[model samples]
Target: MNAPVFRRVLALLGDLRLAILLLLVIAIASIAGTVIEQGQSLSFYQTNYPEDPALFGFLSWRVLLALGLDHVYRTPWYLTLLVLFGASLIACTFSRQVPALTTAQRWQYYQEPRQFTKLALSTTIPQGSLKELATALSAKGYRVWQTDNQLYARKGMVGRIGPIVVHASMILILLGGILGALTGFMAQELIPSGETFHLQHIIQAGPLARIPQHWSVKVNRFWIDYTDAGDIDQFYSDLSVLDAEGQEVKRGTIHVNQPLKYGGVTLYQADWSIAAIRFRLNNSPVLQLPMAQLDTEGKGRLWGTWLPTKPDLSEGISLIARDLQGTVLIYSPKGEFLTSLRTGMSTEINGVTLTLVELVGSTGLQIKADPGIPLFYAGFALLMAGVIMSYVSHSQVWGLQEKDLLYVGGRTNRAQLAFEQELVAIARELASQSQTAEVQA
Candidate 1:
């Protein structure tokens, strides 16, 4: 690109108004991403947002798919916005913040006494000396510099660099966000107790995401805790991470809100279900039946299995369980309630002895891996430091000694009232010291 064109483009990108507009648009898109379900199937959108009477008259499944609302964060346009915003931050940092900081760091000494008159807070002390003024400023936490008859003092130079640091931190955050979107993956697995499995059911994955294949996770046990009112208090799963050689590398008991993290992946305990029921019938070999979750119409989750009471499959009984508390309800073939049994309990039904062995529970885990989390942590730390630094007032004071008269003036980028008061106090101290020196003379 030509120099003039490049400069124009840089100016455009560095414009504060443009940056603010982009930030607002990005915020709105983020809100939309949160309101609309992401990473869901097409059927889910169609069922939830029907076309006959579209949501808000325009948010149907077709619109969502066309606009990539179903996966907004992973969309090409969304990534483009992020890239553009990052570029804007870079331009603004280089074009504005850096130059401003450089200017603030350079010293500008006031050689002429008249120069002090242009300052925001200036005063003429008839008998005060520049040495006394410098001493007072130094005592007030200013870094004083003396050049013969001219003097300059400043404090809080870090405040000048604060905007630059803030910009750099924001850039890091953007880079981290982009990296996560390009390389993160999320998967869900429903593993029965005592079973080992790998991440296979991938729900969402970025283009560059690497799915691990050399490791597996085993659920050693799954159980639930109940409150005194019989409500579910919490559920837990004892999990073990195994390497390619089938050797356990890590083990932990994970519950809701407490997840297990290994390598780069994290395993969250999300849900649970009854996998199967083991029992014995009429002294026969032990058999297990898979349980199916029935539609409870919002009453609660219920798992059921059918056990044949007769050898010819002519009669059967339904076994229903509401929780992992070991209580199982048995119903007759006619849908009538028969009796309840617990684990290790036995009851005779239709002349055949039914023994309840165990109820195998499965743990639902949501596994995710993101490579940009460290960058995010570092970026946020810098952002906080930068904000605190920015709050510090960058104050500068100038002094000039012409003959026996001293000129003192100062200015600050922020905390104007406090800076003025500090300058007045320094002037008063200089006058007092001058008087004391005359008395000693």
Candidate 2:
């Protein structure tokens, strides 16, 4: 890139107006995302707003394509805004706060009565000397002192830097957001138990289709815990990282709130489903064929419609038994049971045997990939630094001696009243102590 073009780019990045505009845009877009059901299919919008295809199509497809609302967080424009904001923060650091910090570091105290009368904070002390006041200020633990015809008192002035540091931290946070967006990709999959698969493809759209690849993740098990009231308390899944050879390399547990990290990617236990149901054949110990499993025709065992031949299971009637309490209903067909039996347990009926098998759990895992996290954090730090500097400021008091009298005054960009209160307290304490000493003498 040419030098002029690069400088122009930098200027645009630091432009406050552009940054503010980008922020507003992101805000508006985020609000819209919240208002509209993001990532929903066209049919859902159509069903919800049947009378208005215009609105439905606009929200369902047009807006999604235009702004990447279908994947709002990872949209290029949104990422652009974040980058612009971060650049603005960096620019602000260079253009504004650095100089102020420089100026504050070299601060000197210069005071006079004429300046005092002109000061917003002023006190006329005819009975006390500048040295006495300086002594009083120093006793109050102020580190700033003034000489050369000027008295200076500064206390807790460094406290002003805290907010700037906080702002810099915020910039770091924004930078994190950006980094997490650009170099990051997430792949979602619902893997059924007793099945092994790899995360092979991630959906990334752009000038060309983007396919994201990561180290394979294999789900081992998933479980859910419930509260006493039967509500779910927490959900978790057991997973292992796999090498290219399909060998398990690492293992960990992940939950809804807790995520497992490996190879710079995170896998979250997002959700679960009933993947398959197993049934014992005629009370046999070993013949446990999962009934809810998909058959060649895409029908599960629950559908009770299966061919007599299968690769995994031996050919048979492919029977699935349902529990009927107080009545033994033999159901060979889809909906009807052949006979009705009683509902109580331990009750035996003739001619047929039924046994329950293990229920297979399917786990839903959310996968994420990011490469620019550090840069984003850096921007976040700068942003926080700028904000804190803008909000918090250092101020001090300066005292002066001119022949017969003394002068004391202070000024600060922020919290001037608190500074004044401290100054008054110091002055009053000194006056009271002098009176007490005189009385003792």
Candidate 3:
């Protein structure tokens, strides 16, 4: 590219108007994402957002899917916006903040007394000497630098670098977000106790995501705790991570908020359900019956299983349960009430002894893996530190002495009221000390 074109590109990138416009677009897109759900199935949107009464008179599920609004952060256009925003921040930092900081660091002396009069806070002292003014400035915690009849001092120089640090931290955070959106995955599974499974059934995955195939998990146990009101207090699942050779590498009991983490993946105990029941008849070996959930048409949730009483499988009874409270209602094939039994109990029905065995429960787990969480956290820390540093108030003072007159002036970037008060106090002190010395003489 030509030099002028390069400079024009730099100027455009560093323009505050361009940065504000990008920020506005990002904000609008984020609001749209929050309002419209992301990472949902096509069927879900078709059912929720029908075409008959399209939202806003033309925005239907087909439109949403076509625009890739289902996964905004993963879409190419959204990612392009992030990249452009990051570039603007970089250009602004280099072209404006760095140069401003360099200028703030270099000292400029007021060779003529008229220059001191241009300051926001300036005064002429007829009695105080340059040395006395420097001493007073030093006593007030300024880093004094002197040359012949001119003196310069400043404090809180770190404040000049705070905006740069803030910009850097913001860039790091954006990088972390982009990385996570490009290489992370989410999955959910429901595994019965004593069953081993791998990380399959992915709900959402990024294009660059690499799913772990060598790792497996086992559900050792699952149980629930009851509250004093006979309601569910909490549910727990004992989980183990297994290697390729089926050896346990990690084990832990996970609950709702307490999750198990292993090899950069997190497993959360999300839900639970009764899978099957183990029981046996007289002179018969142990048998496991699979349980099926009945459709109550949104009235209530119930699980049922049919137990065979006769060898011909003609005569059977239905076992119905509502919750993990260990109570089950037994009914005949004709929906006639037979008996109610608890776990580890026996009841004779249709001339056969049926024993109620343990109810097998399965644990529902949600798994996630993201590689950029640490970088995001570190960027947040740096941002907070920079924000605090930005409030420190860079202050500077200059002094000049000629004949019997001394010129003094100072200024600060922030805390203007407090700086003015301090400057007034120092001038008063200088005048009072000069009067004391004259009296002693």
Candidate 4:
């Protein structure tokens, strides 16, 4: 590139206004992503955003799909914005923050007494010795440098480096977000107790996702705790991670808000359902029947099973259960209420004694694997440290002695009033200690 063109490019990258505008755009995009719901199926959008009367009078499912709003973070445009913002941060940090910090670190000596008068806070003490002044400034935490009759000091130079740290942390956070959007995945699975499964029902996955194939999970057991009033208090699932050889590598009992983690995958207990039942007929082997949920049309959730009691399949009984409270309602095939039985109880229908053994429950689990969470946490730590460092004021002081006339001046980039008060205190202390000291500006 030509010299002028390169300079223009650098100018644009370092432009504060451009950086702010990009940040605003990213914020707006993030808000939209949060509100619109990402990674949903096409049917979902079509159902929610019908065509007849579109959202906002013009925006519909078609528009949403056309603009890639279904997955904003993974879309090329949003990723491009992140890349551009990161470039801006790099350019600004290198071209502005670093150089400014370097300039702040290099000390400059005031060679002339007249230079002291230009400071916002300047004074002259007639009887104060240079040794006393230097010692006083050093005691106040200033990094002092002295030469025969001239001295220079500064403090809080870390303030100059704080902006660079803040920018670097923001860049790290943005990179983490981008990495997560490109390499993470989420899925859901429901497995009955004693059944094994793997990551199969993926709801959302990034392009570079590494789907787990060599590992499987088994639901060892699932149970629920009920309160006194017969309401559910909590549910737990004992899960075990199995390797390719079916060897258990990890195990944990996970509940709501408590998740199990293994090999970077986290499994959360999200839901539960009645899966099946174990029962026995008179003088026969135990049999298990898979239970199916019944549709109540928004009334309540119920599970049911039908058992045939006759040889020719002519007569049968129906069983319905609402919860694991251990009570089941039995009804005749002709829609007559028969009787209610609890777990470990038996009933006779058509000369066949049916014993209710146990109800098999399944655990609903949500699985997620995010590789960038550590980076995000580290970035926030740096950002907080940088914010505190930025609060310190970069203060500077200069002193000179020209033929017994002591010239002193000090200033700071921040906390100007406090710096002025500090100067007053130093002047007062010097005056109190020296009998011949006279203070003047």
Candidate 5:
């Protein structure tokens, strides 16, 4: 109702404690999803957990639908956590750290006369008598400013700014990541060989939105290479370029590391599949085999009938199908006979000549487009920079001038002990310089 109440509500929502708690919960839930397997059908979960009532109940379709655990990052609650984390970082920047930075940046040298006079490292030098001390301080890279009544000095100011740069980078990165998660879309499609298709709606966006109406892509060819040991070493695809108007322009290939780009959209080589297979009866005429290829429609093209050039049927035959699902087809050369078969399944025909045995299939093409990718990447770089600056830096200084003294101190978000050591060193340097200046003056 009031601004104060609203601010307080926002502050509580953006608290680091709440963020940490949400992060932990999200992490645990993510691990559970991975362990239990996500996207599994209700029947699968039920089958796996048939004997465990608790697991069955927890993994029930109703529970998953209610909690949105099936799609964690996209789920409303998970997205809410991300929003909260971003708000917390923003609040921390404005509320707790900005003032601290201002004080540290504008830090000035100050101390009481009595405090300096009672110090173990104080010295009383004649006026205009500390030129050599100034030279030594200058050599150590301190910016020295002085009047007859007082002195002002600053050192490592640029170095001090490093932390700020790093922090700003982190905030930039966080904001970028949040923006991307909110606005970006990444989708994949598998086009079997001989099939023609265009980019459709993205199924993977955290929130479903119309895919960029301006974007679309098509896969022309896909290939894979394997080591002698049967390990995959590389994968790639040749793609036909298409505009939203369905016009063909450029055609090129892309590998796992290299992606094809067109009109601000990038198509990645995601996967492959068996497009089709060809089989002709043995003892059949060469003419009977006919032309077996994929047509523009992506369907298997076969021209000719089961009747063979040979008048007599000879021996039984084999048809081997390949791909994830190996469905085979067997037929006789001379007669009207055809039968269906699957991988690892075979039959003995009395007189069937399955001569030209062939295997075929299409490569599944995967497409993706996300305008926020660059922003997300830039944000990643900035966030890391901020974290390093916040944690690894140390800032401090001390001064002794006749009857007056000053101590200035500040530190990075990390390594307080190292910061204290640095503070002690600066103090020692000033104290030692004072003692030497008094002796010479």
Candidate 6:
């Protein structure tokens, strides 16, 4: 590109209005991502946002798919916006904020006494020496620099650096977001107790995501805690991380809100379900049957299994469990309620002894791996520090001793009232010292 065109492009990208617009668009896209279910099948959107009436008169499954709203964060356009915003911050920092800070750091000595008259706070004091003025300004926390007749003092140079730091921190945050979008992966698993598994059911994954193949996770046990009112209080899973040799490397008990982290992978206990039931029937070998959750039509979770009481399968009883608390409700072949049995309990039905062994529970875990977490933490910390530093006032004071008259003036970028008060106090101290010197003479 030509020099003029390149400069124009940079200016357009660094415009404050453009930055605000990009931020607003990103915020709206985030809200849509949160409101719409992400990483779902096409049938989900078809059923939820049907074509008949359409949502808000214009939004339907077709629009959602066309706009890539189903997965907003991973979409090409959203990622492009992030890249553009980061570029804007970089351009603005180098072209604007950095230069402003450089200018603030450079000292400007007032050559003419009339320069004091143009300042916001200026005063003329007779019989005041440059040495006395420097001493007074230094006493008020100003870094004083004096020559034969000129003096310049400043404080709070950090205020000038704060904007540059803020811009850099924002760029870091944008980079972290883009890195996460390109390299993160999320998966879910439903593993039965005592079973080991790998991350296979990938719900979402970035194109560059590196899925770990050298490790596997095993669920040693899964259980639930109940409150005094029989409500579910909490659920827990004893998990172990295994290496390639099937040796345990790490173990921990994970529950809701508390997760296990290993090798950049995190496992959270999301849900639980009934896996299988073991029992004995009529002196036969121990038989284990898989239990399936029934569709309760929003009533609650119910799992059931059928056990044959006769050798010909002509008669059987249905075993149903509502929770892992081990209360199994048995029903007759005619759908009549028979009796309830707990774990290790036995009851006779159809002249055959039915023994209830144990109910195997499965743990549902959500696994996630993101490579940008460290960058995110560092960016947030810098952002806070920059904000605090920005609040400090960068004040500058100038003084010139011309013969019998001393010209004093000051200015500040912020906290104007406080800066004015401080300058007045310094002037009063100089005047008092001059009077004390006259009396001693």
Model 4: per-residue Cα lDDT over 1-441, one tens digit each:
999998788889989988999999999999989999788899999999888799999779999988888888889899999999998998899889999999898878888978887899998877667778889999999988999889899999999988999998999899998888789889999899999998999987778999998999999999999999988999999999999999999999999999999998899999989998888889678889888999999898899998889878888999898887778899998879999988899989788998988889989999998887887998999999899889899999988888867788988999899999998898777766665444323
Least accurate 10 contiguous residues by lDDT in model 1: 124-133
What are the TM-scores, per candidate, against the unseen true structure? 0.98, 0.73, 0.95, 0.93, 0.68, 0.97
Q: Model 6, range 11-124, lDDT digits (tens) per residue? A: 998899999999999999999999999999999999999998999998999999999999898899999999998998888888799889889889889999888889999998
Give model 5's clash tally: 20
Model 2 scores a C-alpha lDDT of: 0.61
Give the alpha carbon lDDT tens digit for every residue of 1-441 in model 2.
998987787677667788688778878977876876655666865565454465645554554556667667667777777767767777766555565566666765664467676666766443446667777767767665556567766665454555446546656777666666656666778887656666654644233223434457777777777777755688778888877777787889999878988777778888766554444434446343333433546542222323232345443233332211112233433444444333222212233354444445678887776655665666566655556555554667777767644566677777778777877776676556656756886
TM-score of 6: 0.97
Tens digits of per-residue lDDT, candidate 1, 95-191, equal 9988888888898888787787789999977778887777788888999999878899999999988888888898888888888889999999999
Model 1: how far residue 76 lies from native, Å: 0.8
Cα lDDT tens digits, model 5, 202-283, are 5556443345555345556555666777455776677777666777777778877677776656777666545444444443
- Window of ten residues with lowest summed lDDT in model 4: 432-441
Q: Which stretches of candidate 3 lie over 4 Å from their true place?
A: none
Each prediction's whole-model lDDT (CA):
0.91, 0.61, 0.88, 0.89, 0.54, 0.92
lDDT agreement of model 5 with the native: 0.54
Indicate the worst ten consecutive residues by lDDT in candidate 5: 285-294
Name the lDDT of candidate 1.
0.91
